[model samples]
Target: MFLAIRELAHAKIRYALIGLIIVLIASLIFIISGLAKGLSADNASAIQNMKADYILMDTDAELEMTKSFISRTDLDNVLQMDGIEQANSLSVRMMNASVNGSDQNEDVALFVTDGDSMLLPSVRDGSPITQEDEAIVDASLQREGIEIGDRLVFGEESELTVVGFTDSQRYSHTPVVFVDGGGRETINAIAISVDESRADEIRNAVGNSFDMVTKDEALKGIPSYSQEQASLNMMIVFLFVITAFVLAAFFYVITLQKRDQFGVLKALGAKTTYLAQNLVGQVVLISIMCIGIAMGLTLGIAELLPEEMPFLLTADEMVQTSILILIVSIIGAFLSLIQIVKIDPIEAIEGAGK
Candidate 1:
């Protein structure tokens, strides 16, 4: 460790170049990861907010909430089953909304459910929506100049008064709006709260006509959720591989360039293990410093992002990425030790003189 620190301080230019590479790669990983998570949250926050443990959809509908139609009879059947706590209809629809009489329209995801149902998001600014013509909206609507008491028009006759604003619960990248669908009891799906063990029982009771999937499984049913997640995951995998190879190649070259120096150290009674430790320490020190700088940059950039942009950097994610990078870098650095261990001090000194 002492030798490694001395070498790094004396060879500032060389170490700085490697550190810069680490910073760039680490920053790319952080930014891409944030994007992946943000996109997922934007796609499913509405469903994620549901208190229900399971989401029931028509099996024939292939898990798509938009395609599932749960009639009053199906809903009542599920509610009657043993171990069931509560069940309610939830209708999901996408529609254009605008303040009444305004020509400008913004796309919004509409969640129509029983007005008194507990499925409604906890209001942050005003009271929960209870009437046929009232609605609760995600805070994202505020970006478009919407506020409490503003009446948003839906279709030809339904005009909803914005009774409240709630924390973000966007679906498919659009803000969510909760409205009372009075006299329209038919629904896209049913949300149920039940014990984990009873989920199978409920599935049996509902028979082949219904599909009961945990909330997490239901997320894949949303359009593009799987594709988006898969693409970003692949990018991360590729980045990790690329980073590993790059570090290995860089350290291998550095070791080759310093062959005579390592040979001299070995001749002076330095153990192969000691030389290996020095190399590992240098890699770790460089990686840690670069990762730290990258984290600071990522956080600084996150604060500047627009609220509508779904970029999040959770602590767990940061720690996981940092640990993975360090592990891979250490492995790459170790690859260079092969040449170090094979060095014959006498041969190296003779070759250097020639």
Candidate 2:
């Protein structure tokens, strides 16, 4: 450790450049990971927030809620199944809503279920919807100039009064508008709270026409959710691979520069393990310092972002990714260690035969 520190102090400029590269790569990983998580939450938070453990959809629809259509009879069959506690028919449709007097029409995802259903958002600021044409909307609408008691026209004849707002209840990247009054015809998917032990039995009882899937599984059926996540996750993978290669190359060059020093140390009674430790310790120390700086910068960037732009970095995500960075850095440092071990003390003392 002392030798590693002394070497770093002696070659401050060289190590500083390496540290800068590590910092840039680490920051890219953090930012890209946060965006991946943020986009996922934006696409699925509404379903993720629900208490229901399973979604019952038409089997023919292949787990997609929008493509699935369950009738009143299909819901009844599931309700009668063993271990089922609660079930509610949910309908979602995209519609254009104009603020009472303005020509500006916003596209909103309309959610309709039974008035007394648990699927309804418990109001955060105002009263719950108790009648037809009365609705609760995601809080994001507040940013769009929507206010409580604002009447929104759904169509020429259909209009709704905004009765309440729910916190962050977005679906498929769109703000959700929860309403009442659509009967069996509007039933698209059924949300169910089921006993885990009897989950298989429940699915069997629902028959061949319906499929029951977990909440996360249901989200993958959303058109944009899977594709967006895959592309972003692939970007993160590439960034990690690039970091490994860059660190390996940088450390290899540094090792070459110190070949003579390592040879002298070995001739002076230094063990191969000791030289390896010093080399790896430098890599670890540099990685920690760079990663720490990257974290602080990432938080500052997050604070400056507008709420509409999703960039969520959770504690678990940071911790897990940081561990990965350390591991990959250590792997890269091994390249230097191998060269150190291969050094011949005789040849090193003889000055490379020159």
Error at 311, model 1, angstroms = 1.2
**Model 1 whole-model lDDT (C-alpha atoms):** 0.88
Could you give candidate 2's per-residue lDDT for residues 281-343 as a string of tens digits?
A: 999999999999999988898999898997789988998999999889998888888999999
Model 2 misplaced stretches (Cα beyond 4 Å): none
lDDT of each: 0.88, 0.87
TM-score of 1: 0.94
Candidate 1 residue lDDT tens string, 33-99: 9999899888898888787888889898888899988788777777788988888789999999878
Worst 10 residues of 1 by lDDT: 180-189
